[model samples]
Target: MPTLALMWEAKAAPGRAGDLLAWARAQELDPSPARREHFTAPGERVLVITWWPAAYDAEVPELPDPPQELRARPVHRWRFEQV
Candidate 1:
């Protein structure tokens, strides 16, 4: 079976990057992925990457959006299959 990687990115509002990062790290997916990672970048961006052993289009659990007050903009997401 192919391994699918899900990427979720979001920017925090003003000085709330720590809060957003903490919230993202604390999320628990129902059927947890095989692997998960969290990272932060410049401009208060938080990136989460989860790897699953499933089809590209399979229904997988994803992190839900954080509270509006913690975000600078809507979250961004993408999915990819390991070649």
Candidate 2:
């Protein structure tokens, strides 16, 4: 079967970057993914990526949204299939 790359990104509010990072680190996805990675950027942006061993159009699961108080804006999500 093909694999899909799922990504979720969120920007933290001022001075709340560390809190956001900690929260992201503690989150666990249900129906677990094949592989996962996390990243942090300068503007307190946090990203979570998971590789799922399923078809490109599969109905893969997603992580829960972070609390409103922790984010600068809404979260963003994307899905991609390898070439």
lDDT of 1 by residue, 1-58 (tens): 8999999999999999999999999999989999999999999999999999999999
The C-alpha local distance difference test score for the whole of candidate 1 amounts to 0.97
Segments in model 2 whose C-alpha atoms lie over 4 Å from true places? none
C-alpha RMSD values across all candidates: 0.5, 1.0
The alpha-carbon lDDT assigned to residue 17 of candidate 1 equals 94
Clashing pairs for model 2 are none
User: Which lDDT value does model 1 have at 32?
Assistant: 91
To one decimal, what is the Cα RMSD in angstroms of model 2 from the true structure? 1.0
Candidate 2, residue 25: the lDDT equals 81
**Range of the 10 consecutive residues with the lowest summed lDDT in candidate 2:** 55-64
Deviation from native of the Cα of residue 76 in model 1, angstroms: 0.2
TM per candidate: 0.98, 0.92
lDDT of 1 at 24: 98
Q: Once all C-alphas are superposed, what RMSD does model 1 give against the true structure?
A: 0.5
Candidate 2 residue 60 Cα shift, in angstroms, is 1.7
Query: Which tens-of-lDDT digit does each residue in 1-83 have in candidate 2?
Result: 78899999999999898888889888887888999999999999999999998878899878778988899999999999977
